[model samples]
Target: MARIKPQALLNQSKKKKGPSRISISTIVVCNLVVAVVVLSLVTTYRHWSQRSRNTLETQSQSHRFEDTNAASEQKSYDLPGYADINTSKGLITVELFKDASPEAVDRFLDLCQKDHFKGMPFHRVIKNYLVQAGHSQSSIPVEEWTSKGKLRGRLNTSPKHEAFMLGTPKTKGNNNKDFELLITTAPIPDLNDQLIVFGRVLKGEDVVQEIEEVDTDEHYQPKSQIGIISVILKREL
Candidate 1:
């Protein structure tokens, strides 16, 4: 071969170096592109996973809502019936728990059906606490007894004064045997066994509290007689 000049040889070396540099740059660019693709895939996967989890959670919440609504509907359908006792002081509405306490509810319903609560004074009133009422002595025997003669005969048949006493039971343990109403606030002793709470005052708690606040005599009877004008039961919800 003919001898090449040093400058020509240097130029040839530079030309070779340029291709190597271009190759290295190309390799670097390819590696960077692959890294970016991998990063993009990872980000997409993470986002999709998060979205799926959120969607599942939302679906679960929707199911729970449906279940809760169904339960509420069932409860509304099954709720016990209520009665309104229109008192001189105010109105008292009670939801009868016949399933929880049958005898108690039956006795109360019997009296209410008879309209026995007309013009009966609340016998005992305790401030912020309770009231005991339903006495045969409030009105004349004729007026005291409800128009329905069924309960009158039952009560009149009893020789004992306690038997006819409203809220007082002939039997010692059963409070509901008679119409002896006890205003319930604090926990009463032996209440579950000794007495059955047949009714609850839904609206006249303020009236009960007012009655309770009034002064009582030595017998704990309210100074002012809080009378119940009438107590009626409505079957409609």
Candidate 2:
């Protein structure tokens, strides 16, 4: 120690310093790298979260639009329900009011659904008066109608049968069987409610007119064979 020079002491002092410049630089670089990695992680997380939020919002909007369309379509059609009576002439759709005549409507709908009126002729057609169909027999024998007290003379009432009325003549007796279906082109209320009025024409009045105008024999049977091909029951609009 007594022989040590000043330069040696200075060298010793440099060796004992807090840290080398290179070591401090290395620590600063490591810290910078760690900071950059943390910043990247934060930016990636933010971007993913934003994208997920946008996707969810788009799906929600699409669902709402679909629901709205479905509701609108349902509301536009089939108010109370009806039927399509297809004939050789054309389609005749009738909208039933069951509340007015429940039994008549029920029987008519059943017959139509079963195709009971298929190939039946509108045998009776009095121009601008009434058109009759939905029976296998051309006419309910005159005696049968008279015996049931439905001959349209017992009660001489006012008003010729109203236009476009779907009615069944109450010719069936105490057994309560449903009878012939007739649509009145003009008002003829003299039959004393002989026809159980039920439903009315909804569409195809022109077809009815065509059927009425066809040429007929002396017995009121159509010469051109205007018959019912089918009766399609349209329970909805």
> Which candidate should be chosen as best, given lDDT against the real structure?
2
Q: Model 1, residue 223: what's the lDDT? A: 78
Instruction: Quote each prediction's TM-score.
Output: 0.48, 0.55
Over 1-237, each residue of candidate 1 has an lDDT whose tens digit, in order, gives 999999999999989888533578888999999999999999999999999999999999999999999997776455446777677777766666555555666777777677766777777654433466767322222222223443423433221121111223234444433556656543333222334454455565666666567788865577776778887776564
Q: Which ten residues in a row have the lowest lDDT in candidate 1?
A: 157-166
For model 2, give the 10-residue run with minimal summed lDDT: 142-151
> Distance from true position, residue 53, model 2, in Å?
55
